[model samples]
Target: MRPAPVVLVSGTETVLADRAIRLLRDTLRAEDPTLEVSDLEAGSYAPGELLTLASPSLFAEPRMIRVDGVEKTSDAFLEEALAYLRSPADDTYLVLRHAGGVRGKKLLDAIRGGLGGGVEIVCAELKRDADKLDFVSAEFAAARRRITGGAQRALVAAFSDDLAELAAACQQLLADTDAEITEATVEKYYGGRVETTAFAVADTAIAGRHGEALGLLRHALASGADPVPMVAAFASKVRTMAKVAGARGGGNQIAAQLGLAPWQVDRARRDLQGWTDEGIGRVIEALADTDAQIKGAGRDPVYALERLVGIVASRGEDQHSPQRTG
Candidate 1:
């Protein structure tokens, strides 16, 4: 399809917004190799700049003018943009990049109300694991590459904290290999991220693997992983297990009720086995203390972490048990 005369790329997801802009640029360039591309910073825009770029050249080639930071646009840019929307130029693509603010309300209102007859591309944040998984799948799908379901989930779990990193991981896998992507592939590429390592420690600890959890925790800390997020990982997994502990329903139904992804609900349900409500509550209490200690309430953060691991591994019973004798 031909590019819209005016395009509004709005929202706070920089990765998605940049992808949208690049796709538009690539499409226009393919349609007309002689496409004249120009970039204007709306935040520092000068008067008449948009018109200067949008004006017809002697060669009269197609033009693509991208206006960025529209959410912080100056008054002059705002006025001229509103006017441009009143009459968008022919054979020209005007893309307005807005990262969300109230700075250019009048102009945004005009464009949204059909003053420019433009198409909107909203890049909302990918907050849910399901959404992030969809993003990973689409990235691979766009390249006509294949990725297994387990690989998709593993990638999401590893890079769940950063969309950019997740996207980069996908791109790296796509660029580096030709084989069908699998869970082992994802682990090979991103098994060392702090989020991944932290979650590993959390999983080991929560499953009663006391020695393994301590080993993983120590390795993670030695690898420069912050203690706060390590505790947070435990808190996150245990909290999820707590949320779905007694809930009875299909994964989708329960996930909706708990505001979690279906995969997360399923994983939590699996983690909840052999765990009682009382055990979960005791773990939560230990997590609170460990969180504070890791944040500087105690003398030895490492010891606090070790203690927390032991507590979780014992299903929150280790803390109350008599100390082992030498």
Candidate 2:
């Protein structure tokens, strides 16, 4: 619909509204003055405020009423909004934004149920991995940048999973390289995911420090950290534990595979001296789960990592903890 009176755009971040508004504006004649964009989220307006602006002089342009901060408004305020949406003014556009959540779900549903056709622009968050990929493709298309699947995943892996951060990284990389967007270019310019970030994230997770791990994961992901590399790094350490255990009792194939000097392998055996096979097994399993999560098998990468650390670190004692079987 060129002018949808009721638009229900919901998401964690209000990143899409700007473009949605622009797309709606472009539908109008260029010289209209009444084109309005409202930030009604401050609070839904009283019915009286819904009054359309007086018609401009014949030469003046059209008008638009944009309401923002709709979620911030009270229930009564939202209820009053229905009156305006009931009969939206012609020659004007209205846009409403909700940051998304139950705080105002009813009002949103009502808007959609009612004046949905009048909705002009709707852009919600792209939270899922597939949505993120779609965003990357769209961004590349907009830039006329040729990007392949490898290039897309590379961008996703280099940028934090957050859509805005990912989008910003794409923009920055696109600008800096001024070349076709490809995997190699993304890797070359966007691979600096910060020093020891993966290590810190993994360590805190494995230490059973949920709060610390969460903060670290959020910080890292927000800063455009690559989940795949982080998972790989963490997996590498778990494999190390596995190696140490395997080599603990004359089973040195893993040590040899890792290219450890005899002395180094000996040190590893010493470090793993008291760890039982089950202890190491649990840790490896947890690591596998972490890997799966990073690869999109599980939910909430941050939470998954947190649970992994807890399961691994806590299981060391359970290896000896008495069984509860009756």
Candidate 3:
């Protein structure tokens, strides 16, 4: 397949955009082993620099030029790029990356409108659970492997905050294991990382599983999870539960009122089971005290965290029990 004279890889999702560019580069290189590759930032180059780079090489070798941050490119650079697009070299492949903005709308439109037979590959951000799940599935599919649904969800939850990290994790799993990816496989590989995450600890504690919560807390700290974020996580969960418990109306309504995702509101409701208003209050109060201590007010932050976890897990049943305190 012949590469397009110009390709616009646009998106706010950096990881996806980067992967698209890499795939394009690899495809080009496979066709021509000596394909020259140049990665440039549009904003960093002066006027006419793009044209200079895209010009036919002295050795007449096939070339791929990747220009990132085109949305922030100067007017002069844009003008030069447009001019080059009008008469693009057959042997040169130009990749323009715009990170979803109005900064270079006109240029984007012109390119998409078919200037130099330009093609656009969009890497839009994956915000929904479905989209993320698709990404995970695609990653596995690329390796000619399949991941169990349970394993996919676990991987997504484990690296929910960072798509790049999620992709890296998926790639690592692919490289490390030849068998089909399963829930147990994901847990075996990422269980330690998941245990240390604040949400994991918070979930166990709020579910009133004292022993499990305490074990998770100890593992988290031992795995280098800081005391401050751990406390903050507990506080956040308690606050959400309190809000959901007190809010009137259906789950969707409460979710909107609290600015939480519907699933989050639903989970909060479940976590509120057997948690009286007084219990919620007590846990929140304990969290506040632990937060301050972890910050600086008291010594032995680790002990403070353990106490907070115990109090939360006990669900106000034994706020001052010797077992809890110890």
Candidate with better lDDT, 1 vs 3: 1
Error of 1 at 3 (Å): 1.4
lDDT of 3 by residue, 185-232 (tens): 998998756433877788787787878878878887887887877887
Instruction: Please write out the lDDT profile of model 2 over residues 1-326, one tens digit for every residue.
Output: 35654555555444465456565666653655455443333353454565634233365555665565565667665766666566655555566656555666666776666653544244665667787788889988998877889889876665543454567777887788766777777667655555356766665554545457657767887888767777676676556656666542222234467775333343344335455778678777767777788688975676665556555445444332212233
Estimate, for each residue in 1-326, the C-alpha lDDT of model 1 and write its tens digit: 23799999988777787788889999999989999999887877889999999999999999999887788788999999888988988889999888787889888788788898888889888999999989999999999999999999988888775577678789999999999999888778776678778888888888888888889888889989889889888999998998898676545467679897654774676577788899899999999998999887998888888888988988878752224334
RMSD of 2: 18.1
lDDT of 1 at 225: 88
Estimate the overall C-alpha local distance difference test score of candidate 1.
Answer: 0.84
lDDT of 3 at 35: 97
Error of 1 at 1 (Å): 8.3
TM-score of each: 0.63, 0.54, 0.63
Task: State which candidate, 2 or 3, has the greater lDDT.
Answer: 3
Candidate 1 differs from the real structure by a C-alpha RMSD in angstroms, to one decimal, of 14.0
Q: After superposing candidate 3, which stretches have Cα over 4 Å from the reference?
A: 192-326
